[model samples]
Target: MPGKDSKEGKNKNQILADLAMADARRMIQAWTPPVWDEGRRPRISLLRAKKAVPSADGTDLVDWSREERNLGWDMYDKNFFADVVDIEGHHYEVFKFEFIEDISNKMKKALDDLEWVALDG
Candidate 1:
């Protein structure tokens, strides 16, 4: 937020925002009961209203969707991915960029196990 005053500062604001979001999500999941079947086929908030949905991981997805609507798609140049993460009894949007490396490694292990496809040699 310190750099939001200028173009460069604006970028920093985004990065900080992203980091904060990730931390919040981690804090949330840590407290909640662990969900076993994380593939609950959660509902998208944009499509559903008033009803709170459970994610595959059993997190309250409604909160995430609400925040997205609040933030609007245009805020981040319309070129970003939104994710639901929990923090302190609340869920929020955690940009994919916030944990690219961590997610990539996890994905790699999953792909390796599935033999989903051949990795580039």
Candidate 2:
């Protein structure tokens, strides 16, 4: 894991993953939260949250906007490549997902903290 320690020389995914984790850590900025774990590499799971704002007639949200969002696990992938996004049209945005709240803490070690993360949003 020498490469893991020396972040400077890492590839795109590794560097990005480190940055993602760092950003998350900074955002939480709590004395105790979830620290990155290098053991269990996280598996990217697809998530779709529909926009819930109701429209006229009070029917389900319209598909004109699709109201669909794409989100997945942010992690480092050196052995393989992985990316998921929301593609509604020519325009698109990378989606970021918080680790499932209940599992975020306990799942830290279960995630490969050493790997960098990114999303081609």
TM-score of every prediction relative to native: 0.23, 0.21
Segments in model 2 whose C-alpha atoms lie over 4 Å from true places: 1-7, 30-121
Candidate 2 accuracy as TM-score: 0.21
User: How accurate locally is residue 9 in candidate 2, as Cα lDDT from 0 to 100?
Assistant: 53
C-alpha lDDT of residue 55 in model 1: 42
- Return the lDDT, model 2, position 26: 76
CA shift at 73, candidate 2, in angstroms? 19
The digit string of per-residue lDDT tens for model 1 on 1-121 reads: 6535544444564556557878877896676443335434222212112233334445343345454533343353342222222222122222246545544555455445435333331
Evaluate residue 63 in candidate 2 and report its C-alpha lDDT on the 0 to 100 scale: 33
Task: Point to the candidate with the largest TM-score.
Answer: 1
* Local accuracy by lDDT, each model: 0.41, 0.37
Q: What TM-score would candidate 1 get against the native?
A: 0.23
